[model samples]
Target chain A: MTIEDLIEEFDDLGDWADQCEVLIDMGRDLSNMSDNLKTEDTKVHGCQSNVWMVAEVKSEPLRIELTADSDAMLVRGLLSVVLMVYSNRSPQEILETDVRDIFSRLGLDRHLSPARKNGLSGMVTRVRAIAAEAVGLQS
Target chain B: MTTDMSQRPPFDVEAVRGDFPILNRPLESGRHRKGKPPAFLDSGASAQKPQCVIDREREVEEQFFANAYRGVYYFGARVDEELEATRSGIAKFIGAESTDEIIFTSGTTMSLNLVARAWGGKFLEPGDEVLITEMEHHANIVPWQMACAERGATLRWLPLTEDRRLDMSRLDEFLTPKTKMLAVTSMSNVLGTINAISELARRAHDVGSLICVDAAQSVPHRMTDASGQHNEVEPVDFLAFSGHKLYGPTGVGVLYGRRDLLCEMNPFLGGGHMISQVYRDHSTWADPPAKFEAGTLPIVQAIALGAAVEYVSGLGLDRIHAHESQLLGYAHEQLATISGLTIYGPDLEHKGAICSFTIDGAAAEDLANLLDIRGVFVRHGHHCAMPLHEVLGVQASVRASFGVYNSCSDIDRLVDGLQFALERLIVAEK
Candidate 1:
């Protein structure tokens, strides 16, 4: 689903509890990332949780597909939300996306802010780097 | 949540709780949870300030504000007198011989850094070793590591046993002739393992090694005798603890050193107040504390900390310990009932009032966040002790630590929060 759809779903939720429930459900719904893919190269540093993320560049469309996992259920749920915004999009598109605004609207800012230096922000940093690298290679 | 309070003296917890205004005020998250009072179990991180301490700080700042020891003005004299009185009170609190041994620093981290840099730099030689524990807070470990590396000294570890207590059996092997210093925590910030400081001090003295204690966790909870007058232990050469952890303001801590040791050591930070005679060629240093306290100290905070010492002294650490020990037993019993929860330290007998644990599928941060929703504050992650976390065989764990103000109701809320978190996150794991 698109980031807009996710935002709408979150907005429809009544309170923090509903939003948390939906987030956890989304985390549960995330496709299982292979254990083998969770290597040192895929690890995201500066996170309190153990998070792993890998980005693949689609040659035809120059789009980045992101896959990630976390030992934390909430982080996995956050990964779902982050992935929804960044994955399956062109490198340029991902670069232009305002992920912070989206997170603020969802009221997940307090739960996962950049100040935390946690999984969500670390994933975003990794994603942006991969996208920028892809752009650098293309040029 | 009914604790065994039969053996202890009458502890008026409600009266104690009334002194801390923050405890009565509902947390910001309480809006969602029907204005629930905060079950602040993160005192192991930093205790909440009492109104008296807060008032003391305001009284200092508003009434007689001046740089300590700088002027002969009335305000300056009042400030210096107050600072000296605070220092004397602290020395008395820890049973230090003289007020000069107590050097005020920013916090426990600063206190540890000061001792490691100043004392270790002056004494440690090549081929010497500094023995520390694997379960120490990073504040205790990293400073020593840096000091050792800089001074060409070897750093060694005293590993923890399976139950998370220090393996004292290996003490002889670790404490050799070359062991110049034995730096250890009085209590583990994460595991709550209360190390035998007196025993360790005796053993270190036997090997002719000076012992420095990171008492950030211990000093607030129990009695500490640096001079070892009443306590069975030998005099601790160096001891450090933070004021904030003792329910005072932040940015103020005490570093108690042996008089001779403080006099012999060079200053960690060289600046204005530390110098006695200043020439362009070279400068001589001041007496013990002034030699160490090189800048404008956290004047108001230190005075407030004096008030904190007074408050804790009035309540008596004995009663606090009794109340907390019983509460800790209750917490252990309650937390154990939850399926898949594994507490990481020894039984109540071997530890303090802190509880660190992990559930089967719920991650530490997730559990902590969920607890916050219920107005229960806890600490998550490695708690600045990564090596201990590695030893515990987990990436991270949730910690619910208690203070004098905490009650059985806090534990109930913590249990309630954990159950809710388990129901929500564990199911999500599937």
Candidate 2:
């Protein structure tokens, strides 16, 4: 689903549980990244759960796609939200996207605990860094 | 909620709850502070201040309103009197021999930093070793590391046993003479393990190395015996704990060191109030305490901490410990009912009022968030002990810590919230 479509879906799901179900469902749909690709170079720290995210840059239209996994169901659910925003997007678009605004719009900022908010912030940092790396954009 | 545990002896929890005005406070959300009974379970981090402590602070600040130890005026005199009274009170609270032994700092972190920088930096040399455990909070670990790097000293580690207690089996090897010092927590904040500091202190003493106990987790819950104790075990040379952790205000902490050690050490921070006399390029420090308290003291916070001492002392540590242990047992009993929940501490009588746990299929942060929405606030994450968590084989965990104000009903609410969070967070794959 497009990021906007997923945001709409989250809005439709009035309850926190329903929104979380969508996150886990998205995680179930996300392709498993190989362990070889989950090296120290790709592992993102500061997550409350073990999360490994990797970015692929392609030159056809200068696109960057990200795939990630987490040890905890809730984190995977949260990652799905992150992936919906940045995955398979152009490097320019990914770099330009305001994930904080997205998190606020989703009400995750108010709903999530401080620790989760920080971990999600870290995930956003890692993703933006990857996109910025691909197109040499300033973060 | 279990009525049996709540009605325990020596602790009147309802009365204790009355002391803290902030308990069951309104919840703040989305620009509006709404209503919710504060199920504050994060005393593992910082505690709710007692109403008496708050009143005392306001009174001191509003009435005294003067810099201490300098002004010959009545206001300054009152500030000095109250601050020193708090100093002595803290000394008595921790079983210190004298008030000179108590060095006030910003918090546990700053107290430890003083121990590392002022003491370790002065004494440690090349090839000297400092030993600490995996259970140490970053406050205890990082300062010594900084000292080791600066003075060419090396650092060693003590591992955690399977039951989450410190592994003391290899004490002889770890406490070698080259090991000039050992820093250890008196209790594990995350695991809730009550360490035998006296036994550890005696061992370190036998090996000719002093030990510094981080009693930040212990002092708030139990009686600290820095004086004579059971088993004929001598007190450690130094102990540090925070005011905030003990139901006092923040920005005040106590570092109790042996009198001689304080006299011998260089000051951590160099400024006014700590010096005896100052030259253009050199300065000599005053005696213990003032020698260490270089800047304007956190007068009101420290005085309120004295009131906190009074409050805790009035309840009695044994009673508080008993009440908490009973509540902890009830929580352990209840949380154990959930099949996939993993509690991380050993079941022991002396354990602190803390439970750090994780569910098989849920994130610690999410679980804490779920509880938070229900107005049951808890701490989640590595709890500043990433290595201890690494040893436990988890990235983070949810911690529910208790204070004198907490009741069995709080634990009940917590379990219900956890079950609710689990309903959605756990997939069938679990």
Highest-DockQ candidate: 1
Tens digits of per-residue lDDT for model 1 on B330-422? Answer: 999999899999998998899998999999878898898788777888989999998888878888999999999999999999999998888
Per-model DockQ: 0.58, 0.31
Give residue B80's error in model 2 in angstroms: 0.8
User: Where is model 2 chain A poorest over a 10-residue stretch in terms of lDDT?
Assistant: A14-23
TM-score of chain A, model number 1: 0.89
**Model 2: residue B47 alpha-carbon error in angstroms:** 1.0
Query: Evaluated with lDDT, which candidate comes out highest?
Result: 1
Model 2 CA deviation exceeding 4 Å by range: A5-29, A59-61, A112-139, B1-10, B26-35, B229-233, B427-430
TM-score per candidate: 0.96, 0.90
Q: Which ten residues in a row have the lowest lDDT in candidate 2 chain B?
A: B1-10
Displacement of residue B202 (Cα, Å) in model 1 is 1.0
lDDT of 2 by residue, B268-375 (tens): 899889999999988999999889999898888888999999998877777888888889989999999987999998775757899999988678867876676577
In model 2, what lDDT does residue B404 have? 87
